[model samples]
Target: MVLYADPRRLRVSAVAEEVANGCAELAKTFRGPGAFARGDQLVRASLSIVSNIAEACGRGTVPDFRRFLLHARGSTQEVLAQLRLVKPTTEEDRRLVRSLQSRTVLVLKMLNRLYGHPPPDR
Candidate 1:
């Protein structure tokens, strides 16, 4: 039997979804007056990664796709930087942020590989 996987379930999509969910989860932990604004920025950047990847995949040519993937990779890095500004008091919160960071790195690596570019040195 031939099994077909949903195109939306591609590796980039899955990673983007995970990043979105992680941002949402992190936003829920904010409580102060300025929290909402900061959280919104984080959410927007995280969601951009998802949309950019989808757009890249739909583009007609390899170069176009690579350009958008680079944008998506930049957004991933942006989200990671935003996440660092949040002070997670609990172990659970710390773990969640760490997980998101790890996933972002993985996605960046995947995008670089797809574009035939070497992963950036840390």
Candidate 2:
């Protein structure tokens, strides 16, 4: 539980949370007649991104952290795919999805950089 010394530590989690909030906004916006039933998975997956990153930071070893980072990246990709399938019924939905899509892409890129070349355990 000692990974947040750096001021930049909030990068990934912040973006992940943004994605989650975006999903929630979508769900709330479309609340009724299933409340965007397909979004259930989307929301959960976005949340996974945040949780995995947090889990990674809490791990006792670098390898475990890296592994959870990979999981976060996978969840990021899932969010992207779900965003693609989101049938926005309003301009607000379209805007939200577009914003979420870009942010999700950024988070994926961030995760890729974070764990793609982590230093070897030494």
lDDT of 2 by residue, 36-78 (tens): 6766888899999999988887676667878889999999999
Q: Give the alpha-carbon lDDT of every model.
A: 0.79, 0.80
TM-scores, all candidates, are: 0.84, 0.83
* Per-residue lDDT over 1-122 for candidate 1, one digit per residue giving the tens place of the 0 to 100 score: 22222328568678878889889989989878899998999999999988887877666666666788889889888988898888888999999988988887888787778667522222
Root-mean-square deviation of every model: 6.7, 3.3
Once superposed on the true structure, which residue ranges of model 1 sit more than 4 Å away at CA? 1-9, 117-122
lDDT at 10, model 2: 55
Task: Give the winner by lDDT.
Answer: 2
Best by TM-score: 1
